[model samples]
Target chain A: MSILKVNNLSVSFKQYTSGLRQTTHQVISNLNIELVSGEILAVVGASGSGKSLLAHAILGILPLNAETSGQITYDGEVLTSKRQEQLRGKEIALVPQSVSYLNPLMRVGSQVRSSVRKRNAKQAQEEVFQRYHLKKEVGNMYPFQLSGGMARRVLVSTAMVSGASVIIADEPTPGLDKVVIEEALNNFREFADQGCAVMLISHDIESALKIADKVAVFYEGTVLEVAPVEDFEGKGDRLRHPYTQALWRALPQNDFTWIEGSI
Target chain B: MRWQLTWNIVTFLFWKAIKMASLLVAISFISFLLVKNSPIDPIQAYVGADMLNVSQEQREKIEEYWGLNQPVMEQFMSWSSAVLSGDLGTSMIFRLPVSEVIGERFLNSIALMSVAWVLSGVIGFSIGILAAMNTGTWIDRMIKWYCYTLASTPTFWMGLLLLIVFAVWLNWFPVGMGVPAGVLAEDVTIMDRIKHLILPALTLSIIGVANVALHTRQKLIEVLSSDYVVFARARGEKGFTLFWRHGLRNIALPAITLQFAAFSELFGGAVLAEQVFSYPGLGQATVEAGLRGDIPLLLGLVLFSAIFVFVGNVIADLIYRVVDPRTREGKSYAVKQ
Candidate 1:
């Protein structure tokens, strides 16, 4: 069953192009996607493809200068700003892209614990930290004291500890090593297996496919194709869109072809 | 690791103390030069009406009594030794020990400055938060206008305007002085002292409020837009809960640093405000000492103020360590690793 749905969504920002001149740039236009229980929907795109904007829209954390028009629903109810506020961190949690998102002033342990509203916060935090391969002492450290990999693990642990039904993890594995990356992906896979939905936003479609049940190909601020994970196996034969086929072939293990401008 | 970190911090504080001592010595020597080289004749300034009546020999004797007859280096050495021996010498204007006069004046000044410091910090920080939360609205614009106007205002002119409006026009508070004349000192109540204090304190605080408010507002705006704060909001934090947890803690370090940076400005304003009101505080004494060529009293006030500002800065640094983990733990931990 679908836990979250976005229909005919559009996101634009009012920015100053030059002195005394303001222009509205549409970042995401008429986009559509859904997140279902017991599934991972990987959003794969190059940078600036509006992948993060979708996450921000779903979380209702877009900047003040943003202008958004969309019908977003969670659990069959319209997710208005007020409704989004109510569900955020309880029913939905976000693992943000940048490691800088961790509060520098707060201890990593306390930061993870603050998100746990239903269960024993300390216990939940400790459990997540242990599972994420973080040393118990790492919890007592501030964000600045953490290595890049440690900070990424802490960000992932914050969402994992929240016990939210929907988790949005964005570009969360860049600084991590192979072993840690696999563990993080496996954690998300296990998290989705417990009848919760996961939206993994990434540029690395290769790693995303290891766990993502369905992959949504993002291009030019919109979803060009969202196919089951199996459909991404072969070359241009199975994939519906030319952009999606091009993306698959462009991977080094495949054709490594260049289409130019589609991305 | 923690033990090593603690030792590093202890060493850091020891070095800071040595630095402060060196700074104080430099400040004192510089102040002595400024006072000694000035055009005013200390004896003439001290004697006032009696200067013409004193014989040349008596004038020489008076100069000898104050060590002014010695070589410049000799004068400085004798003064330094006297200071080392715990004597700040006699005030040429007051005819009493400099320390005693400074103590009495400092009590009154401390009350005025302390009140102004706290009032401005609380008031400025609140308006800053208000403006940040209401950015681009009329409320923010109004607060910005008020802070900018106050920022450009002179403390003395502001004091005079407040005096005219509150004392002359309104007759709500006292016109000047710390106490009402002809009233016995024993009979003066706390309310009387507070009433006299209100104008000068308000003048000093209004000037101080502008810098803190503008800086805090700008900092909070940046903090609110930061990725950490945005992530905090995404985690179901909103309203005062969000602000209390994320907003206040993040902006507090900058706010405090800015507040403490205003310490020198606070003293400068106090001098002007005290002059405008004729308040018998250390600021008034400072001006009196400077103009009357009372080197001992002037030097004493300068040293006292330097210590005062140093203590304030130390307190701010301690608070920063408490409120910000990066300053205390991050650098040391990074070093250890």
Candidate 2:
């Protein structure tokens, strides 16, 4: 059964124009996807394809000016804003993209521990830190004291200790070295193997294909096709969407070809 | 490493002291130069034009006695050296030591300004947070309008208007002066002093609140939209928890710096408010000293005002260090290397 399901989701922003005039710009439309238990669904798309917006929409953390339509279901129930608030950071957690998302004023350890729902939050946080290769003393350090890799590990640690069943990581591997990227992806794989759902949003198709059980090709705010990981092999024909086939062919190991037109 | 950090702090303070000393000398020299070049004669103002029967010998004697016969540079050197030794020159008009005259009024001004500062800071920050939280709502628009209107109103005019309404029209507060006549300093009740203080304090505080509210509102809005705040909201932190823990904490350092930047304006507003209320504070004394061409007293007041501004800046820097651990960590890291 699907742990999370989004159906025909649309997001538009209302903005004021000259004088009393108003305009609505639809950024995302008719987007649908699902995450099953013990599976990793990676949403792969180019920049400005509204990949991050989908994650934000799922989390119900969109800006006040944004208006969203359609339905998101979690655990077979309609996920309203109230349910989003209730489940967020408990049943569902986000691993944010920007390192600046960590509160500069807060210490690394306590920040992670603050989201722990377990009885032994401290022990859980420290164990997660150890799992992420963060030294015990690094907990006392503020976010500004952390290097790029260490900060990324800290972000992962925060999501891990949240005890949430659904983890949405938005472009978590950009700007990271190979070792850190492998570690982060391995952690997500381990998380999925434990019967929890993971939504990994990324522009890096190569990294997404590494751990993703299923790949959903996103283009122009909508999912073009959702293909199983096995179908991605020797692509072009197995991939249903032309864009996905083009994307697979564009990979350097494949034909290294280029596609025309912007999403 | 600890020793190195200590050494850094000590050297920083020593350098700050040296800079402040040189700044004081430069300010005093410039003030003296302006006073010396002015057409008004301090000695003439001192002796008074009414003393027509006084002879040239007596005038020459008075000039000699006051060391007015000395060249401008010589006079400045003597005055600066005396000031360095903690001796502010005698006031030409008051016929008392400048220090004593300033000392009497300094406390009163500090008391008045302290009250205004604290009141405005609390009220303004609260309103700014509220406005930021309710952005695009009627409450936010109302507060924005109120801040702009209050900020544009002149300090003296606001003081007079408040005086008329609260003191004259309603007879709720004293119209002028810091204290009522025949009220001894030791015998004055807190309530009595508060009644006398309300008008000037209110006038000064209105401007401060308006300025701080506008600045803080803008800053809070920026902070609330910052990446960390968004992340915090995603973490399920809501409302006041999100506001004070993340929003207010991030905006505090900038807000403090902005407050210090507005110190000069605050000082000017305090002076005008004091003048309008006839409050016997340093500001009132400053104007009296300037009008009478009391060169020694005016120079002393100028130096004091400059020192106050410098101290405000130093306090702001200290608060920044306390609020931001990054600054402290950077210092330690630098010292380690």
Candidate 3:
């Protein structure tokens, strides 16, 4: 059963194109995806392909310029903006893309502790930190004090301590080393194993494939195919959509080139 | 770790003190040069129309008394030595010790400036927050227009306008002077002083409000749109809770820096406003000393103002570190039990 479902969502806005002239810039259109219980759905797309917009849209944190139309049902009910606010950081949590998402002025411990909605916040944060191999003293440090890898772990810990039913990790592995990347991927897998729905948005399809149960190939602001992870192996011929097949063939370990095919 | 944080603050303060002391020495020397080079004759200005009647013998005696007969360097040395020895010399115009005059007038200036300073910072900060939170709205535009217009207006002109309207036309407050006429210092009540101070202080604060409000609005807009703030909002924080938790401290650091940097502007405005309203503060004394060639009084005022502005900035920097945990380089603001 789907714990979170986004059906036919479209996001567009009007902006001034020239002197007193306006144009509608549709960044995402007719997008649909779902997060089911105890599974990792990796949504892969190129940069500027509305990957992050989908995440923002579902969280109801889109910019004011954006106008979104769609039905987003969470936990068997339509998720309104008001309901999103109540569930945010409690029933549903987001692991943002950049370390900049951490408040520079706040302590790492306090930041994660604030996310713990139901439990002794300090103990929950400490347990998560220990699981990630972060030092006890790291809790007192600011975001800037942490290395690239520690910062990412701290971000994940913030979500883990929340114990949310659905966790959305957005572009979490960019600029990270292989070791740290594997650790972060493993952390997301653990979250899904604990019965939470996890949506991992990333442009690095290769990394996403390592832990993802289902791979959703997004192109032209819409999902071209949602196939099981095994379908991506052995030349990608079993993939239903031509774009997904091309994307798989174009991977560095594969063809490294995207061939034009039937739409 | 606690010990280290405390030690760091002490070291910071010590260095600031050393810097301020050296700056004071430089300021005093330069102001001395500027004062000595002035073409105005101290004796002539001091005697007024009686200069022609005074014989050469009387003139020599007067010059000798004030050490004007000595060489420039020698005069400076005498003044500097006296200052180093805790004496600010005597005011030639007022016939009292310079320190005594400064102390009495500084009390009055402090009252006016403190009222103006607090008023401007609190009111301007509130207005700035309102404007930033309501960006692209009429309230934002109105605040921007008001700040821009007031920033370009002269302090004295604003003083005069308020004088004409509130004090003259509306008869809301006293038109001028620091107190009621013929009232002894002992007889003047706090209410009387407040009534007289209202107009001049308002003039100074109104001018100050423009710079602070505009700066705060710009800074807060950037802060509100920052990534962390967006993330915090996505974390179910909004309205005053979001602003209080995330926005306040970030803008406050910059606001404080701007507020302290405005001390010189505040003092400068007070000088002009004092002349307009006949307020018997240090600002009024400043102009009189400069125009009358009172070296003791003029140098004294310059030194006092330099220290005043410097101390304000030092306090501002200290407060910034206290308010902003990032400045301490990962030293946690709170200790876990």
Candidate 4:
């Protein structure tokens, strides 16, 4: 069953050019996507393709200047702003893109513990940290004291300990080593296997495809294709959109050829 | 390593002390030179025309006694040595020890200014947070307009305007003065003193409140848009929790520094306010000493003000260390590394 659905979503920002003169620029237009129970759906796109905007919109965290039009349904009910606030951090958690998302003044353990909805929040946070191979002492450290990999793990643990049914991991694996990235992906897979859903947004398609059940190719603020993972194999012939095929063929393992146009 | 850290802190404090002492010396010398160069002679003002026709021998004795006959450098050396030895010299106008006069007035100024500072800080911070939370709304625009208007108005002008509206026209508060005349310090109740204090304190606080509010609003807007705040918002934090837990904490250090900067202005405002209101504060003493060409009293006031500013800065630094763990740890550990 689809746990989340977004239909005909469009986002535009109003900017003032001069005194009392304004213009609206549309960034995302008529986008449609869905997340099902026990699935990892990765949305892959280049910079400026509005992949992050989709996650923010779903979380109801779009900037005030942005105007969005869409029908978003969660759990078979309309996901109103009130409902988004209600579900956020309790039922739907996000692993934000920037490590700076960790509060500089707060300790890592408390930050993770703050997101836990379970009774034994401390135990859950420690367990998450142990799973991520973080030292016990690391819990007392601030964000600045942690290395990049450790900070990323802390962010992931914050979401993990929330016990949310749906997790949105936005570019969570950058600056991480190969082993850690694989471990994180496996954790997501294990998480989804327990009947929760995951939306993993990233530009690194190769790593995303490693665990993604479905891949949605985003280009120019709209989804070009949402295809099964198997379709991404073998010279990109099965991929429906030319942009998706070009994206696949341009991979270093495939043709190593550059796509002609800039995003 | 622990010993080394302690030693570094000790050395840092020692250097600061030495720097303050040198700055005080420079301030004293400059003020003395300015007073000496002025057309008003302390002896002429002190003796008055009644004593002007006294014997030349007696005049020489007075000049010699006051060390007015000495060269400028020698005069400074004598005065500085006297200051170092705990003698602030006698006020030529009041004929009292400069320390005695300053000590009495300093307490009064401290009472007035501290109350104003606390009042302004609380009101300004509350308004700033409210304004930031409602950015682009009419409330925010109105606060911005009020702050800009208050900031552009001169301190003395604002004081007089408040005096007119609240004290003279409405008859709500005392027009001026720290306390009622002939009222014994022990006889006056806190409420009576507050009644007298309301107008001057309010006058002194308006500029500070406006300044703090504007700065806090600007800083909070930036901090609210920061990545950490957005992340916290995504964690289901809203309203007061978001502001108190995240917004205020981030804005605190900068706001405190700005508060300390505002304190330097308080002394300047206090002088005008005290004169306007006939308040017996350090500012009034300063002005009287300057007018009377009382070099010793003027020098003492200048040095006191300089030290006050320096101590305020030091306090700000210490508070920063307490509130910000990053700064505390970085200074200690990074130095060792």
Instruction: Give the winner by DockQ.
Output: 1
Chain B TM (all candidates): 0.94, 0.92, 0.94, 0.92
Off by over 4 Å in 1: A18-20, A133-138, A233-235, A260-263, B1-9, B64-69, B331-337
Q: Compared with the true structure, what per-residue lDDT tens digits does model 1 show for residues B1-337?
A: 5676578668867887998999888998998888889897888988888888999999999998977878888888888889989899898888899999999999999999999999999999999999999999999999999999999999999999999999999999999999998899999999999999999999999999998899889988988989988899888888898788888988888888878867888989999999999999999999998877887899999999998888778767767765577776655543443
Off by over 4 Å in 3: A17-19, A257-263, B60-70, B330-337
Off by over 4 Å in 4: A259-263, B1-12, B54-58, B182-191, B331-337
| lDDT of candidates 1 onward, in order | 0.88, 0.86, 0.89, 0.85
Worst 10 residues of 2 chain B by lDDT: B328-337
Model 2: lDDT equals 0.86
Could you give candidate 2's per-residue lDDT for residues B1-337 as a string of tens digits?
Answer: 4575567567767887788889988899998899889987876777777568778898889889878899988988888889989898889878999999899888889888888887787788878878988999999999999999998899999999999999999999988998887777898788887888888998888888887788889988988888888777777888888877888778777777767766677778888999999998989989989888888899999999888888787767766755577875553322221
- Model 3 agreement with the true structure over B20-130: per-residue lDDT tens digits: 999989999999988788897888977888888999999999999988989998988988999999899788899999999999999998999999999999989989989
The single-chain TM-score for chain B of candidate 2 is: 0.92
Error of 2 at B201 (Å): 1.1
RMSD of model 2 against the true structure: 2.2
lDDT of 2 at B265: 74
- For residues B93-205, what per-residue lDDT tens digits would candidate 4 score against the true structure? 78899999999899989988998888888788888988999999999999999999988888778888888898889999877777777888899888887887777778888
Each model's Cα RMSD: 2.5, 2.2, 2.9, 2.7
Quality of model 4 by C-alpha lDDT: 0.85
Itemize residue pairs with steric clashes in candidate 3: none
Across A1-263, the per-residue lDDT of candidate 2 in tens digits comes to 69999999999999999997899988889999999989999999997778998989999999899999999999999999999998888889899986799888878788888778765889998898888777887888888878777888888887788878999998999898998888889989988998889999999999889999999999888999999998988756888888899999999999988778733
